[model samples]
Target: MINEIQHTAETKMQKSLDVLRDNLAKVRTGRAHTGLLDQVEVEYYGSMVSVSQVASITLLDARTIGVKPFESKMAAVIEKAIRNSNLGLNPAAMGDLIRVPMPMLTEERRKDLIKVVRGEVEDGRVVVRNVRRDANNDLKRLLKDKEISEDEARRGEEGIQKLTDKYIAEIDKMLATKEADLMAI
Candidate 1:
């Protein structure tokens, strides 16, 4: 029972870290990244689909992304989807491919992106702490139910705290690195 609780807690904490990593990937750093459009959905026929599902996205240059639609007819739809995305990229339709040029970030825009990243980091920290709280509660419940002794529950709680600390530290490091990336010219 004790081992089960520890394993569950570790799993939850690891998931929180994964969430942080995914969030960080979505944040742009003034570079051309196909991942930036990973969340964009384009209207395909009568259904909405991920842009990547219908098109191949590639980095044509340091500041340009080339999106080639599998179906030539979907070129306009893909361009519109990228234009409408919050990424602020303008797509130019060039035959079967749409070229998206990444714009230079203004000082104000860079600061705004940093603020957004900071907010995401705080949310990730909260998720880690919430996992710790849940695991601690579960440990206490186990002790009360006579499944685990007080000493075992205490040790489990300590282990969960350590996991929480490690994940939170990882988030902090990611935030710092992202901030630097965003601020760089």
Candidate 2:
């Protein structure tokens, strides 16, 4: 049972790290990436579908995103979706393709993005800590129920703390990378 609790905590902690990675990916770093539009959904035939479904998004250059709808008629729809996605992006309709240019980040904007990244990292830290707390609680419960000896409970708690430290370090590494990316000109 202690092993089970440890496994669950590790799984939850890994999930938190994955969330941090995905959130960081969506944060703009003055580069054009297809992941930037992964959250955008376009209206296609009365159904809300991802931009990738209705269009092929590619990076035309370091700062330009190229989106080509499968159907020429869907170009306007895809462009409109990008405009309304609240991502602060403007897509220009160029014949059958839509070009979304990633604007350069101002110094102030870069600072602001850094704060956002920091907040995400903090949240990731919280998630890992919470997992640790839950695992510790499970150990306590097992001890209370007399299902595990006091020594076993102590070892289990130590194991959980080790897992917490490992995951928190992972989050810190990811945050450092993201901060460097945001601060880079």
Candidate 3:
């Protein structure tokens, strides 16, 4: 029972870390990458689909992303989708290709982005802490039911704490790297 609780908590923590990573990726720096448009959705034949499904995304340069839809007619829709995705990007339709340029981050915008990243990191920490709390509670309940000894419960709690610390450290490292990326010219 103790092992199950610990394993479940660890899995939940790992998933939270993965979500945090995805969120951080969405917060773009000055550099451009195809992943930046991963969340963009476009209307396709009366249904909405991701930009990648209807078009191909590639990095034209360090600061520009090139998206070319399979059908030339879809280019306008893809450009509109990217513009409205609220990533603060401007995609111009140049014939069959849509060029999305990542604007340079100003000092103020960089500071704002850091604040946003810090908020995301804090949310990640909260999720990990919540998992730890729930696992500890499960251990206590097991102890109360006489299924686990007090010593065993204590050990399980320690193990859970170690997992929490490890995940939190990884989250912090991601934040530090993102901050450096944002600050770099």
- What tens digits encode model 2's per-residue C-alpha lDDT throughout 1-185? 99999999999999999989998898999888999998999778888889888888899999999999899998888888889988889999989989999888899999999999999999999999999999999999999999999999999999999999998988889988988988888
- Model 3 residue 166 lDDT? 98
Residues 1-185, candidate 1: write the lDDT tens digits.
76777788778878888988898889887899899899999888799899999999999998899999999999998998889998888999988989999999999999999999999999999888887888889888888889888899888888888888888888989998999999999
For each candidate, what is the lDDT? 0.89, 0.91, 0.95
What clash pairs does model 1 have?
none
Which portions of model 1 show Cα errors greater than 4 Å? none
Q: Residue 30 in candidate 1 has what lDDT? A: 86
Per-residue accuracy of model 3 over 71-165 as CA lDDT, tens digit each: 99999888888999989999999999999999888999999999999999999999999999999999999999999999999999999999999
TM-score of 3: 0.96
Going through the candidates in the order shown, the clash numbers are 0, 0, 0
- Ranked by lDDT, the better of candidates 1 and 3 is 3
Clashing residue pairs found in predicted model 3: none
Could you tell me the lDDT of residue 74 within candidate 1?
93
Model 3: residues with Cα > 4 Å off, grouped in runs: none
Lowest summed lDDT window (length 10), candidate 1: 1-10
Q: Which candidate wins on TM-score?
A: 3
